[model samples]
Target: MTRKEEVFERVEKSILDFDGDKAVEVAKEAINSGVEPVEVIERGVRKALETVGKKYETGELFIIHLAAAGEAANRAINEVLKPEIEKKGEEIHFTGKVLIGTVAGDIHEIGKTIVSAMLLASGFEVTDLGKDVPIETFVREVKEQNPDILGMSALLSTTIPVQKDVIEALQKEGLRDKVKVMVGGAPVTQEWAEEIGADAYGVDAVDAMKKARKLVGA
Candidate 1:
């Protein structure tokens, strides 16, 4: 295999092995080997996570596996590849800026984390707010960051209401029309998303990336 292809293989394998350190190490090696940072992210990290997503969907992998793989890929991208891209004065050509979080009272982050990694791999500049994010924090972030898309994940039916609350809060702050809102989780449905006035609904990470791209005309 060519040197670039070999580096891509190691990067993908590092994520599959769920080794963040190895991912970073491979990322630096890729740069030193003259592999473009964006190519490493798209061809290496993205491909690895796509496989991880499929395995998780097929029940061959558990949530822990998905989380570990996603986190490892994200760490390498954020900590290594991104800095390299910056150093080379290369604009990432991101699809858009996305702010994502798991709504309050829901500590479940596996779904959100996977979606965040997928979005990042798909060329979206993602800002993850982590789990149990308050409605006010979402609103505050929307106003402050002014991202193109805001994605919320809630794993529990009880916390699903928090998604609506956040939307309403955004409306109250006069920020609802400024950004497209996407919602997803185990219990979130198309009907629920519409009822809550979300701009889009994602059934999974891949679907989320598609919908997000469409949301921004990317």
Candidate 2:
């Protein structure tokens, strides 16, 4: 097999084995061997996560297994992939710009943070607005940053309506169609996403990254 393919196999194995150190080691090796950082992430890390997702769906793996893989993938992407991408001179550009935050009255951030890291690893420029962000804040940032996607998270059922509020604010400001909106969290559903006029709903971080890529045509 080619060197890149060999390294990719190692990466895939490391992640499946939940070996963060090995994943990082092989990822660095892949970069040192002149593999593109995005290539390593997309072909190696993402493929592993896709398997993890399938395992979760099939009841072959628990939440802990998925979290372990996600953590290992994040570490490899940050310590190995991102650094290499930055070393590529000035020719590199982000896959897209994404603004993410937890909606108003929601003090939860774990899900949002995970989604942000996944997007960043996937080569998207991300701006995290943190938790308890007001609807006006979301609207203002959308107008200011002009990001390709705006992702909102709400862990509480009560705060879920804040997503609709933000969307309405966007429409009132004439910016609803300017950016794609993605909504999710523990309580979010595909029905709610469609009801609120969101462009997409991600069930997890990996799904969010995939949807973000599609939104940007990457």
Candidate 3:
């Protein structure tokens, strides 16, 4: 196999092993060996996460381990991608910008973090508003940033309603149609997103990135 493929395999293994630092090292090796940033993410890291998720589904890997794999893969890509992102900046320009947040009354952030990483990998600049974000924060950020997409994540059933509230707030400000909106999390579904007037609903981070790209025409 090629050196780039070898580095990718190593990074994939490191993520499955939950070794964030080592995964980053392996990604750097891939970069030094001439792999593209997008390639590292769409190929190496995702391949690792797919395996992790399959193992999780089979009960061979626990939730904690699955979370760790996501974290590790993200960390590795973050390191391996910085230079290429900069290079791409000078070439294609960024396709879109994003503002991401976890809704109010919910403190979960891991999933949102993963989505943010995936968006970054796809060349969308993201501003993370973090956990327990209120509608006001979403509105304010959208006003200030005028991003192409706004992504809301709610892991709790209780907080899922807040995602709609944010959309309503956007409409009230005459900004709802100015930006594309997306919703996701454990309790979120495509039907819910459609009912709430969101542009898309993603079941996972990878899907989120794809939908975001489409929403922004990027």
lDDT of 2 by residue, 1-218 (tens): 98888888899899999899999999988987888887888788888877877786688986667767867886887787877777775233568989999999999998998788667556676788999999999999999989999999999989999999999999999999999999999999999999999999999987998999998999
* TM-score, every prediction: 0.75, 0.64, 0.62
Superposition TM-score, candidate 1 onto the true structure: 0.75
Model 1: CA > 4 A from native: 51-64, 93-97, 108-111, 114-125, 144-146, 155-158, 172-174, 186-189, 203-218
Judging by TM-score against the true structure, name the best candidate: 1
Give the whole-model CA lDDT for all candidates, comma-separated.
0.90, 0.86, 0.81
lDDT tens digits by residue: candidate 3, 27-125: 877777777777776667777777776675588976577656766765765565756766777332455888999999999988998788667545566
Residue 81 lDDT in candidate 1: 91
Error of 1 at 148 (Å): 3.5
Clashes of each: 0, 0, 0
Which residue ranges in model 3 land beyond 4 Å of their true spot? 90-100, 105-128, 140-162, 173-175, 178-218
Enumerate residue pairs that collide in model 3. none
lDDT of 1 by residue, 1-218 (tens): 98788899999999999999999999999988888999998889888877987887688987678768878887898999989888889866567999999999999998898888777655678899999999999999999989999999999989999999999999999999999999999999999999989999999887998999999998
Q: Pick the winner on lDDT between candidates 1 and 3.
A: 1
Candidates 1 and 2 compared: the better one by TM-score is 1
